[model samples]
Target chain A: MNALNRKKEETFKPLGSKSLLSRMAKYRFLYLILAPALILVLVFCYLPMFGLVIAFQDYDIIGGITASEFVGFDNFVKIFTMPKFTKAIINTVKYSSVQLFLGLPFPIMLALLFNELRMIRFKRIVQTISYLPYFLSWISVVGMFSAFFALDGTYNTFMATIVGESYEAKNILTDAENFLGILFWTNIWKNIGWNSIIFLAAITGIDPTLYEAAMVDGCNRFKQVLYITIPCLLPTIAIIFIMNTASLVTLNFEQVFGFQNIYIQEETEVINTLVYRQGILNAEYSLSTAFGMFQGAVSFALVCITNFIVKRVSGVGIW
Target chain B: MKKSFGEKLFDVFLIVFMVLMCVIMIYPYLNQLAISLNDGTDTMLGGITVFPRKWTWSNYDTIFSNESLIRSTVVTVITVICSTILTLIVCVGAAYAIKKKDLPFRNAIIWILLLPSYISAGVIPTFILFRYLHLMNNILVYILPSAFTFYNVIIIRTFLSSLPVALEEAAYIEGANEMQILYKVILPLCKPVLATVALWTMVASWNDWTTTLYYVNEPSLFKLQYIIQQIIKQSEVVQKMVNDSALTGGSTSVRARPTSESVKAAAIIFSTLPIICTYPFLQKYFVKGVAIGAVKD
Candidate 1:
């Protein structure tokens, strides 16, 4: 006979003689502390989740969730058949990989560099300069970029003189050719410093004893990094990589929407952005909902696959 | 002791690379600053370089002259204040509750609170929910919908777990109630980590445009981020129209003269200056705080 091992069952069983109500009374204030926040979380976060049911139905604004016609596979079918949808799905995968691939390594490198520093002030300055952009919204960063890169922008001006005067910034995002790289690089530029933070933490968590031991063994700084630092960071690197893989299908929609234009729409489009444009902008409720649900499904699959792999390999996973 | 050639070379390389990157990073901002100071022929500021061809303070003057900008700044400040307070209150409460070893329904509530981050219910459903709750376009709409995030809850919980139980017990024995302990003993000692969380919450709430974009269309309620976004979108629309008109030889020409691009840029720099200005104050903790949340596994 198998029974579920749940917390509620465990809690009551251990202190069986005590009345459940009285036991609750004993810790009443903790419950009181939690009550307002718990209610808010329930009402705002958990409740909105119940509305995911619309994914299974043909949602109508006027008709609402109840009156909406129920058609499951049809919505999913439209999503798969749509060209833009496929592009979005592919773009999301490619962009996330680009982000994780190019974006993931620098932090570990920085952490190693930072940990090597004997001079604290110089290290602080480097860290400060590096993470400056992480605080700015995507909007601000993009504004800064477009100002210098537009048709008459400095970047194009520099290129125009060198390349016989044909360069332009305005067409970069709209050219269908150069847009994806622009989006990818812009994202990297914004996040590189912020991403380095975790690696620094992992490095700092390492025991100084290891370094002292390595130093006593006459291992040079480079050798110490290769042997001691990199190996210590492996677990963290593995975890971040797995999490990145899990979210590979969910690109940052808000950032993409802010930066992308119509020409790049086919190339730079992502599943999240597609959901917004199709469902919210175009008012194709069922189709967008289906695409969103499909995205969720893919991300879930990715997360599970990552969890399995990480669990097997490193004995660590998000779950 | 004299430094070796290798060490000297490495240091030189590091400084050059760092300074070069800093220049690349600040170049765009310097360009924006130049545009803000330029007027007349530079009014368009279109594709202007790292320096203004025509320089004046009129652009900055115009921005300061906007009553709406001033009002929105005040509103943004108030929201940042309130949202940071409310978020810290809820986050500290929930994190403390979750940290209780014997608390009833702890794990269940923790999972329930966090489950929202991973799952996507789609935006329409969320929009409809907000609509139903009578929160659509309300000023509270911006603060309430995202008052507590699961990601934040997890981080604060992690920090709280590292707190010693003996301290809380000592406070309890001294006749300080749970609230008193949270405020006096736990909170005051939590200052460093609290400062980190406070900085993040403020920056995030200040930079947020998604909530405002979806839930609101009112100019009066537009946060700086949303205002900058709308202005950019308008400029993009105009840019697109101008191109279309030029292609078809349509009789219409834009009198706005591509100034929207520069204006959008100006608006962004202005909106962000406050948060960006605080970055130096909190920069010390960025590495530490992110280091914690970055490795959830």
Candidate 2:
């Protein structure tokens, strides 16, 4: 038996040790099919990662990335000193925290309410209407808001009726103080139904027997929801919460840029818009790149940390 | 079982609240439509709610007549079609390749593709790369950069793996090669997921003005959303449109002088019409797509 095993191993060794070229040729069709996507990602995604070296350089348009002078940590130090950069960070935290506190619960509540609906047809119609805004781009949402909140628009007119001609028309879209509130509310409005989908799906996946068991135990509908439904949804909620926490520093660029104006730039200047202004508008490429790298590093660290905690707590995470 | 009085009250309150929420969701679009249809000159007076006081087609007429607006609409349509098709082909192919368990370096290929989705090289690096490649200010910038999304590939691959292996094996036994098997057997089974991804790509492409904002400089390559962005951000674009209307005074009637507000509303409505028209029919697919994405995550 030992001699026969040895012979079998020796016979299979040559096939297992076949050269890469022959193996590649054997799977040429698979490789051929994958080449375009691989090449595209290499050029557009991977190659640019090498270009991040400019974040440590004094990038000039004429000299470009290759000839740019190496500046080491100077770009990072410069951005750290900039008040605008500091303000951007603060604004990002403020906006994201508001979104985290208020914006997060709205969807969960909406999902719970949706699950409580007895009429399927009405529920479907409401859900369809609610998800409509998520499909529209931020540009469209901003455009619609601009029209509705223009100086002489419907909002002002409605205010005038309530205040009886003492009401001065205000452009809420451009109100610096109200901008964060607008961001919070608009986010909820746009994403409440869509974001509730996971929670709703979780609700559906709750074992029906648990509900029947609760009914036998004389638990009311609300009690059943409180005891069984909420507990069941905790895992899904924790996973989503971790994801959201990970993205706390990264504001949606499109939404911020669309809603931003000169009047509200001070309030709405996020890291993303600041980067756009510095890099694209002012052509301060290195400074913007450094800032971008800082944002990326912080976001990655946050994701890793949150993912670790969630995995430890629940044994499930984004990984 | 019969509902208690409290439950009955809660249901009534819930229905009313939901109805109110639906109104909040929908009324903005209705208001915009009313503003768009209202006379451009009269919209400045500001009481247009759900219906136009003085109905006119001049806002849309102005939109159609403006050369830049028309060009942008054409550009958006072309980009949407080209990018959606390219994305479907690239993502489907990549997914199929990755679905092969014995494919050499399969795990390595997946990591290479997916790492970018989480850890990006940031915006400036990407912009510089585009500039170096001469994709800046080029139309290919729109279609190429977004053609191979890792998330879409993962979604497609997951769907493909869920399909029974016997289907592909049966085709292979009939003398079908890998490509033929993929084309003849696998492609037919992937319609639902493909439709979901296709809709997502089309909507994303149609609504993307950022590529134009960051890369393209040529006025002719400006997309619908970017033009609308300009109209909103800079009063000059609206002024330019008004001036263009005055220049083409012989074509349009004098009664339809477009105000900045009405023109902005009209431009917004024009861009949003495609989504608003198709979203109800496509809502289920989007919901399913989100569910699939959630399950994967």
* Best-matching candidate per DockQ: 2
Across A119-219, the per-residue lDDT of candidate 1 in tens digits comes to 78876777677778777888777777766666656777677778875644354645656656776777766776667778777888889899899989987
Q: Model 1 chain B, TM?
A: 0.83
Off by over 4 Å in 2: A1-9, A19-23
TM-score per candidate, chains pooled: 0.88, 0.97
- In order, candidate lDDTs are 0.72, 0.88
Per-residue lDDT tens digits for candidate 2, residues B51-94, read: 99888877777777799889999999999999999999999989
Model 2 DockQ class? medium
The sequence of per-residue lDDT tens digits that candidate 2 reaches over residues A1-319 is: 9999999999888877685557777789989889989999999989999988998999878978778899899988988788999999889888887898668778888999999999999999999998889988898899888888987788999999999977889898877888888888888888898999989999999999999999999998889889999989988888888778746788888888889899889767999999999899899988998999898888888878988988998887888
Candidate achieving the largest lDDT = 2
Distance from true position, residue B75, model 1, in Å?
Answer: 3.3
Per-residue lDDT value at A105 in model 2: 77
